[model samples]
Target: MPAQVLAPAPAVTPPRAGRGYWRRLLPALAVLACLTRVPSFTRPLWNPDEGYLAVQARILAHGGQLYETVVDRKPPLVPWLYEAAFAVTGSGSLTSVRVLAVLAQLLTAALLAALARRRWGDRAGRTAGVLYLLVSVGLNPEDAQAAGFEVFILPGTAAAMWCADRRRWTAAGVAVGCAVLAKQTGGAVLLPVLWLCVTSGAARTAAPRLAAGAALPVLGAALLTDPAGFLFWTVTGSTAYAAFSGSPLHALTRALGNAGLLAAACAGLLAAVARAPRAASADLWLWLAASAGAVLTGFHFFGHYYLQLLPPLALLATAALHTEPWARHRTAVLVSACACAVFLTWGLTAPRAELTHAQRVAEAAARRTGPRDPVLIWGMHPETYWLARRAPASRYLTAGLLTNYSGGRDGARVGERYAVDGAWPVFRREMTARAPALIVDDSRGKPYAPAHVPTLRRLLTDRYRVVGTVDGAVLYARVS
Candidate 1:
């Protein structure tokens, strides 16, 4: 028989990567690029959402339980992050908090680039990183600016996705666990990450490892620190959040409108996924569904909620922009770029609610009150309390609890009680016992009203005197 010779096995070519120098420098450049927001980092806290977290962080730093001393309908992870920041650089320094925030954003951007590069190509990786930085920093409104919980969630989610793609199942689980700790919705990433492990034939081993890795931070924090606090805030307390925020349909409309370029790119991404190889497409589609579920879970789709979708969406968009024919890629890029440009322009130029006014208000309050003096803000400006480093007089930091207790129009609709009306007596008792040294009423241009809670009305009338006014804030000093 003629000697049978096997043809030389086809040589495999490693995918082309950035040139040596570019590879070394790109990630560094991405980090530096994200840090450009350093200028805005030291600005005073203005938005209530950030202020709420900041205040809770301050509380934690001062030996307060996550839910007992301060209350919110979210998880404890963000408060812990803020507490850590306070420990590192002294509590209530806008610069300290913002610096930590910048670092988080930078880390997230770098991880996003790594994920894009590994899944797509070097060019897509760089593009995705740059895109995320711009969209996150530039496109976010003032309310969602610098250290938002959503920003914090990004790095963890991106890390999870990146590790899962590389089959680092345990690390992926840990990363996602961190994300979930940051925000309750972070658990959403768990589905896709475990799915990847199972489909890749590592389910038996990877699943347990992933579960253990994920449970470490959460379980450790819960058991060692505050189990009841975590359970109430993250799960039970959050039940009423959706009812008061907005309907799912309304949230969907607002999310699409605010998401801007990202929404459009997602449409293109769907098309790209449809045309992709079956295995890869399956992963991408599952990821998208998982992200969408996370965003929609509370049925109050805040713009930041859509952020969790960015990594998968960015990957798919990059594929549509670069992996396809020139004509289609060009059209996709142009449409996305144009929409992104419009959103970016608006975000950059849209007049932001100035914190200077808020800072001035907080400074005035700080000057009037002593270190241990309890300060009360009647409205939603928790930032004032955080900036002044003054402890809140009552467990209910903002009036949302008080106003929503009786089924106010602003909350769970007319006649549908949002909070237990039974809590009103407790609210009255807490405020009366605390007897806040100074009350800063922020009605957001409306006259402060204590009508909602009769106890507040009595306290305002009998126990407090209007000491001064700082812009829209009416400062009341305890008199009786």
Candidate 2:
């Protein structure tokens, strides 16, 4: 046969790589949205911390100050986030708060999936996303329902890891700084970040970039607002938090209670080390260790605290799962099945009683007080203040913030310092100055009761009378 000239195969264009990434990410995001979004709406704001955050954000949005008008033992970033959310969607809407929270979690999952895929492979990445969604939504009932600090910082941590893996040192540093702004514990991300910069052949160039990036957000926070207040709350105020929350032993007990999570975390780290030495290096393991320390330092050991561990654990677990001899397809199938099963378990066990009661209380509070009025709540339900659209009668939105619990169970020496005898008169003075339209006694004879704020107790008895009751909380209207 005569040799024939054949036209070169038409230059084939590889479909843009980004399109493939989105194609995979969109479906996963849809699944995560289904797992988190709608369910958040059905749940009520029962967490005191969530309430504190929502109300504080509203205060900041309304031209008031953080740490001055509203005090919390957390960094300013979280409230700033809530402030932005409230600004976009009216401050009065709890749905807005829930939406903000769900969006944060979903973003974390996306970043986590991207990082996993980048470090390992496509299948590993997909597994990481599913695992994160499952564990996040399946957080223990006591701490899972309302958005917490962990949720806000998770995406930032994941983004830092992803950027570091790509050798984008400055961006990764910025991510770490943002995470710290969300919660002081996020500072732990720096260890692994430094590890990456040091290990990367170009340590001199990378380290300085990383440090420069990290300083921008923090410096901005200091220059733009109350540096003194920020220092006090994030640094000084937080010094006493762990002591007041509980002991290290209590945190250990909580960790033991969630043995499955711990097992998975260990498995992933060990598996990656065995199968993918370069991928799971000492620096990465150090990141995991640092993350664990961050979680334990709080000592409170709330279920939400473990959310901080999800990124490293998910990465390790996915790598570990990949090491199995089973076919990749089979391994993926197993991961999907487990995620679905745990998700179902969470669905079945979730309670509705709190939801129903919260609705009733919110409705009652809204009816009794105007949006501009001040409301005094004796116990620690800041959600009611958010729902009522009322300013707190005092900066001590929760009595615990101003009450001395030194001799009590979760005792700490600093309680006397912060909640000094001087605090009671201030609390009484503020309540009198505010002249709240409605006083909510949430105690129902709990330990944080009339005795906790005797002055407020007397004021409530002398100037207000019981008007109605909802979910064990008594509402007292000022006698006109």
Candidate 3:
């Protein structure tokens, strides 16, 4: 340095984010997670899926067996999860299940953040978590906030990805298995995880461990539950469910509509990814593809089904954010911010309406029957059981099986088809074993109406008399 002009002081570098940074950031993420779910907190029912799970859980809590005593096409863990929630917070509390959904989201966010941080850095981690919190609810709040299979499977799915990224092959497998146990589509995570292992050069060691770990939960489930029932409902029945689709043109139209909806809701994230310098890694693309396949499995692109796409999208979007300057992505950022604002506002202002048609029927049914009485609902409203505080008279919660009316299709064509080959016998046997005290014919004019099915019409005529109607649902009382 010259005598009068010393070299400029070395430029001071900002300290790399440390434990203190995460210590503060984690709690902030938790707060954001809770805030986003505020809308689901007040509503007693957000979606029919919740009611289905709630009723199943209620039955399970009251000593009913999964698949055998309480039936649904879903895997066993979600019902068990509901049972656990009911156990802690008391049965028939939608708020409790909603609370658990919040916790699941929070946990998923934290896991994604940690996974991104481990792979990328602190900025990417923070962005990933924040993005998940905002975008996870960017769709219809009714589906997004429910304790549905998608919501419950997320934490496990995220954990599986995180573990696979870290080369924790066995843990990744177990997490994926747990996710599958929540929803059959969760097995889609396995492809990305296997790809991760292959790319990481641990395919041999990791593959066996992953397979073994995955089999643990599934085999345990088979042993713990009714093996035949579990297999039929989850595997065989789900396959049939997924296979049901309309004509090719109609299916394509539906698929396109679903894609458009997804694009609109995820515009910010999509834009951010477009602006990125490089495409996401192959494993991530595979993750996205697998999730898309899962969403399309039933050919019913429900808003909630799009939720499986979020973790991958968030990670990719945050990766883009990490590489690009924030100022350059102002439009995407603003779009995302606005999306979050709109979602939160809707949640806060959504009408806490009076009892739904199902609930009104539930109420009327409840008034007519004792606590121990079993009630039957004729349509797709299994939530009536939970609302009525009554046990279901049959294992078939909804009439889909009885009518061959695929839940994935429009109800107009329901009666055009006959009942599934073996469904009516099971229905008759279950009804005979434990006669329902009240039958709510929610599908009076719909295709699945009892009047359209001779057996159902005869049974209702012989054993039940129309007593009342609530909100268009005809209520029938058992004639002693």
Clashes of each: 0, 1, 0
What are the lDDT figures for the candidates, one per model? Answer: 0.66, 0.68, 0.78
Q: What TM-score would each prediction reach against the true structure? A: 0.82, 0.82, 0.91
Residues 234-306, candidate 3, lDDT per residue (tens digit)?
Answer: 8876654576654556666656765665576677899766554333355676787899899888676677888
Q: For all the candidates, what are their Cα RMSDs to the real structure?
A: 6.0, 7.8, 6.9
* Best candidate according to lDDT: 3
Model 2 weakest lDDT span, ten residues long: 2-11
Best by TM-score: 3
Clashes of 3: 0
266 in model 1: Cα distance from truth in Å? 8.3
lDDT of 1 by residue, 171-266 (tens): 988898899888877777787787677776767988898988898878876775578776776777656554545344566566666566455534
Model 3 residue 214 CA deviation (Å) reads 1.1
Q: Candidate 1 — worst ten consecutive residues by lDDT sum?
A: 2-11
TM-score of 3: 0.91
Which digits, one per residue and each the tens of the lDDT, describe model 2 over residues 182-251?
Answer: 8888888899877777666677899999999988898788666688877776787655455545355665
Instruction: Order the candidate numbers by TM-score, best to worst.
Output: 3, 2, 1
